[model samples]
Target chain A: MAKVATRVSYGEALVKYGVPNENVVVLDADLSKSTKTDTFKKVCPERFINMGIAEADMMCVAAGLATCGKIAFASTFAMFAAGRAFEQIRNSIGYPGLNVKIGATHAGISVGEDGASHQCLEDIALMRTIPGMVIINPADDREAQLAVKAAIEHQGPVYMRFGRLAVDDLYDDDYKFELGKGVMLRDGKDATIVATGLLVQEALKAAKILEDEGISARVINIHTIKPLDEEIITAAAKETGAIVTAEEHYIMGGLGSAVAEVVCKNAPCPVKIIGTEEFGQSGKPAELFEAYGLTAENIVKNVKEAIKLKK
Target chain B: MDAKRITELSIIANKVRKDALTGVYSAAAGHPGGSLSIADLLTYLYFEEMNIDPKNPTMEDRDRLVLSKGHTAPALYGVLAERGFFDPAEMKNLRKFGSFLQGHPVLGKIPGVDMSTGSLGQGVCVAGGMALAAKLDNKSYRVYSILGDGELEEGQVWEQAMFAPHYKLDNMTIFVDNNGLQIDGDITKVMNPTPIDKKFEAFGWHVIVIDAHNYNEIESAINEAKATKGKPTAVIMKSVKGKNVSFMENNPAWHGSAPNEEQYNQAISELDEIIKGLEAQL
Candidate 1:
């Protein structure tokens, strides 16, 4: 299978679908090349604004453009976009409910070599606290393109998370992407594996490993974490009775916390979460994933524990 | 501008000051000093300048203004009400629960507000974005913003100061209300953002200094800003902390404190006398 970074897909989609509408404008804080927003700038230089290494200014600028009927996409590293400029996003964009899309790339522990400062494990938590912010963590290349399209089509504030590392393509061309809806990949009766971002492929691999051990594990990809698909999560909990969640973020407030909130409210099930609990270190991407326990093996181990807890 | 027009604007400005004091007195907790400082400027923009319609506040090609120093929203609200953007009666409901007159300027709630702004340093950048939007769309409408002197302490303001000129946002003009006082004390005593004109000039803006209360100087500076090309203009207006109202003028205590009943009455009466004198001039 071909592997592509979600940031690459997002950049391609912005040029193909976003700028063609003429109302869509792109803003980057001098990280255009890394965030892949340079692709949009290459094609539409007039509509692209290089805000020059100021995250707070870029977010506010995007908010200002939104007020004037422009769909502005502000791109930067997740650490800066969500962590550094959190208040600007909350006050200027979220409070007013403006049509500003935050393209936060290089999220999570996958941002190896640069270590803890560059890897943003708290972006989901920071953005989730805002009143009307819609958070989408795409799983693969196809889903990333679709998430960008959905964000541009949506009428309010949207935060789209992308990855620095490439992962295998999990979906084909015919897949449909909808806001606030989860996609069920493989269904089973024993347990459910809920995942998001780069960990969705890990969840699928974990499901395969569990099946080899005679454990029928269901798989679900929850892209939207804010308006979480409680209906689907609740149904999965009721049918499977056990749930394991995987993500490339902190266990405290990422996909794990979101799924736990839904499961605890609607259906009482034993849910095990596979995510980092500490800051990541500088290493290879694979080594960082292993060190943080964000791998298919960890998801498989958690699934067994959840199944035992259910019994 | 002629004497008659200046007198008419002076009358309107006096009314705006009264309305701003009304909201502050009603709230019992709002920025009165800064609000009073910007009353004349607001009156001039909403009445004599900007091509805006009260009936259609969101009309395309309308010039937009962002109150970067948004704690002074009472003045903006008062000027908008005087311009017939909404009922003047709403001034009393400022900062009350469920009222459209919030403590700071909100965009959709108020008819004439171009952007929601309360956070210092953010509004100026947003105004730059609006100016960039006008250039991208090839529209003739210009963008305007007002900032407090102490607000220059915020680093985001410098970021925008660098941004507006780099992009050559010639369609934007910003006013720095150099009242010289902040919540702590005099701006120089607190944290010197002095040499403000020099800083803007260094940042590549067309810098112009004028007396904020002088209508002739204000109008001329605005004309200079519009005529200048290729760079944004910064009009540094030297002003009194509290322009009118005898006791509040240059008083740091009134920076964010509302007046008591007696103080409120005194302020309103002083403004009323000014309004009467301006009306007689007409």
Candidate 2:
């Protein structure tokens, strides 16, 4: 499959669902083009609202619309949606459990040259703190398209995390998007490489390299991190005996931490988290991935280290 | 609208103020100054202006009210109780554990509260959204919101000032409780949200200035807003911080602090005299 950013598919999928549903409305905080909400705007201009540069206002507006039975999708950069307007989301949307879908793009250090300020690595952590908040971090363009559709159907508040850079297209058209279930891409017996977002492609490549060395590595894609499918994750940990969690986020409280929280309680297995330990810097997407040890090489190295601990 | 109705509302507002003080005194922690300041307007809205039923609080097509300056929930609770949303006796449960009377106006917990608001400058934007929905659904329900003078210092309020007018939310009316004091001190010296009328006018709102405590002015301003067309209205009320109570009026120290036993008795005695005089007028 061709490579495309999840943000691009977000715009495309929104139009797919929004054009047919009269209740579906879109609100943007002045980043329509960047967040890809402009795609829905073109097809359903009447349902789309531009709230200027006010992210908090946009979120509250969405909450208000949701109270009236409108399925409102509010979009902005992850930094603005999850950080700048965090309290609005918590008090206005989360406190009420309104049906406001927060479409967050440009998350993680991979936002590239925009540097540390633009990158949003802690969005998932902040969103997870809210009770009953559904979080979906699609790994590829196809997954993103299905996620947008699922978010439209799902009730209550959901935060859909997307990124700026294009990565591998992992899922096909026939792949179904479940809310909290993880998709095991490859079956293995030695160790499990649980990954999310753009790093899922790197984990696949790492699994292949481990296969050459006769170490069978299982690769699992965690699309939904909040209502995390703990049963599947625990089964993988128990079967493989070793687990390595990778994500395009801060290691402290993201997918790595989420998986570790599940495994430690359920399986009590050896798990190594591969993510950003420090803040990101200015660099090309590829350069930043390599510099931050988020490449296939690093995933392969972490897999071997995890397997050794199991032995 | 008439002098007789104005006197009747004045009596109800005094009870509202007394209950507000009672709730704050019971909690031993609350914002009494702002509560008392907005009591008259709250009484007018709940008793005279807005189309709402306390028994059927979630009725569609009913007018909505968002208290943007949510720390003054004591005033809202008092009005809601007086309007039969809940028993007035429940006002004494304010800030108690497991009590529906939370420090702020929580949406589901309180029957008449339309939207949950505590963070300054957010409720107006939400009210703007509610007005927008009324347009989309072809409903005729109007939306009202009240903002503190100091709450204008929050940037989100201006963001709403821009949005409501841009959308031509004619069914929306915002009341700025310009009591001129915050928790810090005088709003002019504390943060300076002055030129309130001109700022709202600049934001494309139909601006109206009024004395918040005046029943005639409050009624006329709301009628003027309902009559105006093609734009939102901002009725900026020039008000006293702690309006009625002799010791609390214009005092910023009472902005968020609860009254002591003696202080509560004195405030209640002063408010009871106003109620007596208004009743004698009837």
Candidate 3:
């Protein structure tokens, strides 16, 4: 009778983790409130640094703090954090393999209203290409919390992608998330739908619709894009024979590219990728999703197409 | 430590310049102009000034040095090797495959190298970060970073300039090798970074302009930087692009180009005579 909400926004999860980890320091480049680092600032004013609008300087400062045994999380819009601070991350953090977490919010077309310039679609590709950088795109608030905690625990540089919009909370409070491990939400052998970030919920919904038609669909939430769970993905590909990947990013080097890399190397299976092929346009979140073909319906269509290729 | 000792260090810098030329000539490709320009400062820091032990390169309390203009690796490599951080014979492996002496400085590969820096403006920020870390940890270790004048064009350099003062990284000493020439041409024509002293002051740093090749001035600046409190110090060392080599001085072509055998011989002769003159004075 009522539409269900599945997850929390990335901002809420950041606050939950920041309150407990005293060693966790948050830095924002003048967008403290927008990036959700303001919550940490409220509780630990001394630990939070508003580094004006200098993202490059902020990244180096975070790397410095991390080198001194402090777990540092630098928060900024995806555009600034991934785009402006790329060199700093490459040399100072990635080169030395320092433990620094970059929380890049307002990723993809879901950043809506800000138009194309503000939204970042190629961040995952840029971050994942760097050696020793762990890329994580959490699906919702529960996963975002887990991702933040996991990033702190994981050594070396990590880039965590989150969205500006709030989504459904899929995980219960007691659920635990492991780095580089994919979670299978539904079990089926007919077709496999692998997805990440905000698209995981859509894949789950698509699985439900596929079941109504007497098709048993398997849905996996791939949170860790880099150091991908090859064993699990290869197993799923071998068992299902058909696979579809969806993400709120470009198909070139996002989750789809990662899945394709695994499938091409070890498990060759019929695969379909649903994501942005070109730059997103100025529109609402729903309009952008439909325009980019990142909807649950599109996932279902792509999954069926992949199933046809399997035969 | 004193005027006479600084003069002695200057003579040692000339020897370092000779070593740099030989190393680069052997490699057949390296930046010699900037390397010679920053030799005196590097020599004084490694030999006379900084409280460092080559045997314990990773000692937590030892002062840290970062060669931000890493293309001048020849100068740093020459000084570090001369200081016994590693075998002096290993200097021959510059830029060779699997050599610890990479085109740029890499940590752990070379002893006495505090950080790996090659991508221009990024190293200044890293050095600033290290200085900030020392302050946060309440360590007395200071950081010295040498940047090329041409690298001042990168915006990140200015970004670090704005941050260093806010945090009062007084223990950090930055040296700008104002060698006039970058890769293309003179820095003045390429990108004007005039009034450099005032710029550092504007960003809350204590500024000092000195003759870069002058051993006395360099040593004084180092002493002043260590004495000053509450703000980082930037020593704007006015230097010739190629200091000792007459034909290559102020020439941009020699920035990253190796000399012909004849030219290398000529450069060595001039350096050897200078070293002899200093020895005669002693």
Candidate 4:
């Protein structure tokens, strides 16, 4: 299948699922073309609002619309949406538990050419701190589309992270998406690779590499980072004895920390985290990922390292 | 409009001031200056202006008020109590743990509080969103938001100033309590947001200047706002930092400080005198 950016899938999903609902109002802060919210604007101009570079105002405006019974979708770059307008999201949306969906695009270092300032490595961490905030980071196009449907239906403050970089299709028509549930792709008894967002594809590739090397690796796609599927994570720790976590975000508070938190509490196991420890510089998306050690090779290395610690 | 009605509102406004001070004193911490400044406006809104039923605050199609200046929750809680949204006795639990009356206004926690606000600038933008929602549904329920002069320092406030007009939010009206004081000393000394009227006009709003404490002027400005078309209205009411309470008036020290036993008694007596005078007029 053709490679598609999750942001594009998000735009298409907004039209397919969001446009049909009259109460779904979409707001963008002058990044409609990049965020793909323009697709929703093109079809449903009446419900669309171009908020013009003010992410803070855009967030609170969505909260206000939600009060009047509208499912307001506010889209912007993750750096601006989750980083710049965090307090607005917390006080206006999270405090009241309003029905406002933040479609944060350009999350992680995959946002090529936009250096450290635009790349939002801390979005998951920032959004994670807010109470009752549902965080969704889909792995691919199909999951991104399905995630949008889930966000609109959940009826509370939801932060959906999407990427600017196009990723290959990971799931097909047979795939089912569930909120707060992790999908087990390839099961193994040696070690598990728990990954989210674009890294899930890398995890499956790493699992294949591990099998070639006579080492079994389980692959699990953890799309929902918050309200994490603790059962699956704890099961992976107990069944596999060790686990490796991969994501395009920081090592401190993304999927790695979330998985570790559950593992330490539920099932004691050695866990290795695969992500950037420092800020990202402007470069090609593939080059940045390679430079940051966010690759299939690195996941394989971490899986072996975690297995060693377990032994 | 009428003498008897004005006397009645003045008496109610005095009661709101007493109740607000009572809540602040009981809590031993809360904003009293801006709360007192906007007490008359809140009284006017809850009593004479807004299409709200304290009994049915969640009624669809009812007008909504977003207290964008959320530090003034004591005033909002006071007016809600006066309007019968809850028992007046509940004001004593202002910021105590497990109280519905949080430090800042929270929507679901407090009845008749249309939007949750505390961190400045967010509430005004939310109010604009509420106005847009009303226009989208063709609902006649108007949206009202009160902003502090100091709050204009927030860049987000200006963003909403631009948004309200760009979307043609005529159903919305904003009351700027130009009390000239923030947590810091003077707003101009801190950050000059002077020419407040010109700023709103430049942003495509029908600007109206009124004495915030005057019932007739508050009523007239709202009337003018309702009559205007294709744009929202900004009623910049020049007000004292603290009004009614003699010692608190114009004193930035009273901005967020809770009055002591002696001061609270004096404040209550001052409001009692005003209420007695208004009743004598009746």
Pick the TM-score winner.
Answer: 4
Q: TM-score of candidate 1's chain B against its reference? A: 0.99
Off by over 4 Å in 2: none
C-alpha lDDT (0 to 100) for residue B263 of candidate 2: 91
Is 1 or 3 the stronger prediction by lDDT?
1
Q: Show pairs that collide, candidate 4.
A: none
Q: What share of the true interface contacts does each candidate keep?
A: 0.73, 0.67, 0.38, 0.92
DockQ of 1: 0.81
| Residue-level lDDT tens digits of model 1 in A1-311 | 98999999989999989878999999999999999999999999888999999999999989989988999999999999999999999889998899999999999999999999999999998999999899999999999999999998999999999999998999989999999999999998999999998888888988999899999999999999989999999999999999999989998988889899888899989999888999888998999999889899999999889999985
What range of 10 consecutive residues in model 1 chain B has the weakest lDDT sum?
A: B273-282
TM-score of each: 0.99, 0.98, 0.95, 0.99
Candidate 3 lDDT over residue span A20-77, tens digit each = 7766777788887778777677777777767778888788778766755667788888
| Candidate 4 lDDT over residue span A1-311, tens digit each | 87999999999999999988999999999999999999999999999999998899999999999999999999999999999999999999999999999999999999979899998999998899999999999999999999999998997999999999989999997778999999999999999999999999999999999999999999999999998999999999999999999999999988899999999999989999999999999999999999999999999999999999985
lDDT of 3 by residue, B149-229 (tens): 999998888988988888789999999999888999978899898778888899899999999977778878988999999
Error of 3 at A194 (Å): 0.9
Query: Per-residue error at B104 for model 4, in Å?
Result: 0.9
TM (B chain), model 2:
0.99
Error of 4 at B142 (Å): 0.5
**Candidate 4 chain A, poorest ten consecutive residues by summed lDDT:** A167-176
